[model samples]
Target: MTTTFYEEIGGSDTIRTIVDRFYEGVATDELLRPRDPEEDLGPAADRFALFLIQYWGGPTTYSDNRGHPRLRMRHAPFAVTPAAKERWLVHFRAGLDAADLTPEQDAQFWDYVTHAAQFMVNSLE
Candidate 1:
């Protein structure tokens, strides 16, 4: 059987660690914290963990629960400015670093997030 990027990177546990660490950063971020209206970040973290897991090729549970990701559309409610994107990447970089994947795996994962962050920018401000 062919292994997936999810499996290659150590599956759900790694993804959860990455998401948890990312949220740890987000919890204290002024800009990012305002973006999440919820006082408790757990649900948001859970959603993100599921999304990353599915996107990286694990179970389809994210879609199963949330339907199509419609990423840009879903993110439309937020300003998503370039600065916000940069800040988002900074926290995400911490998450990636915590995962400690192989260099190639790290590069691949980073490449996707960099582009995704840029794509998420909905405002020039």
Candidate 2:
């Protein structure tokens, strides 16, 4: 049987850890902090972790709980400028760095996030 990229990277727990780390950065980042209005980051973290888990081929819990991942539409409320994308990538890069993955896996994950980040950009400002 062919293993998935999720399997290659260690599945749900790993994804959650990376997301937790990502949120840790987000919690402190001035640019990103105001984006999440919630005082507690747990809910946001859970949503993001589930999204990554499903996206990486682990499970469909995200869609099951939240319906389709209309990423752009969901983010439409936000400005999502170039600077925001860069800040987002920086935190995401930290998350990926904390994961126990091989170089290839890291690069693959990075590539996906970079593309996804660019796609999320809805404004030049």
Candidate 3:
């Protein structure tokens, strides 16, 4: 009866903390704040938390609820310019700091965020 690294890091609790912190920045960031300033990020937050936990080898809550992430289609409405990309990364990096996860975990987490943000960039204008 031992917890995996996913559970060792506190599973959903840790994921919630990370998502909340990231969204807090997104809510106020100059580059990313305009589109969804007051939008309900609650659902989005839950989705991300579950997805991360599952990806880390925890439960499959994300897939249970949302099939596949299909992140690009989800973010297609927004104009993810370079500034917005930077802002998203800034908030995500801050969340990693707040989580205070191990260096390995931090690097892995940031890798996903970095690639995800890059993929979300739909325009060069």
Flag regions of model 1 displaced more than 4 Å.
none
Candidate 3's C-alpha runs over 4 A off are 1-5
lDDT of candidate 3 over 8-80, digit per residue (tens): 7778778888889998887777777777744787876777788888887799888888898787887888888
TM-score against truth, every candidate: 0.98, 0.98, 0.83
lDDT of 2: 0.94
State the displacement of the C-alpha of residue 32, model 3, in Å, after optimal TM-score superposition: 1.5
lDDT of 1 by residue, 69-93 (tens): 9999999999999999989999999
Which run of 10 residues does model 3 get worst, by summed lDDT? Answer: 29-38
After superposing candidate 2 on the true structure, give the runs of residues whose Cα lies further than 4 Å from its correct spot: none
Between candidates 2 and 3, name the one with more favorable lDDT.
Answer: 2
lDDT of each: 0.95, 0.94, 0.81
Candidate 1 TM-score, C-alpha based: 0.98
TM-score, structure 3 vs. true = 0.83
Q: RMSD in angstroms, all models?
A: 0.6, 0.7, 2.3
Model 1 is weakest, by summed lDDT over 10 consecutive residues, at: 91-100
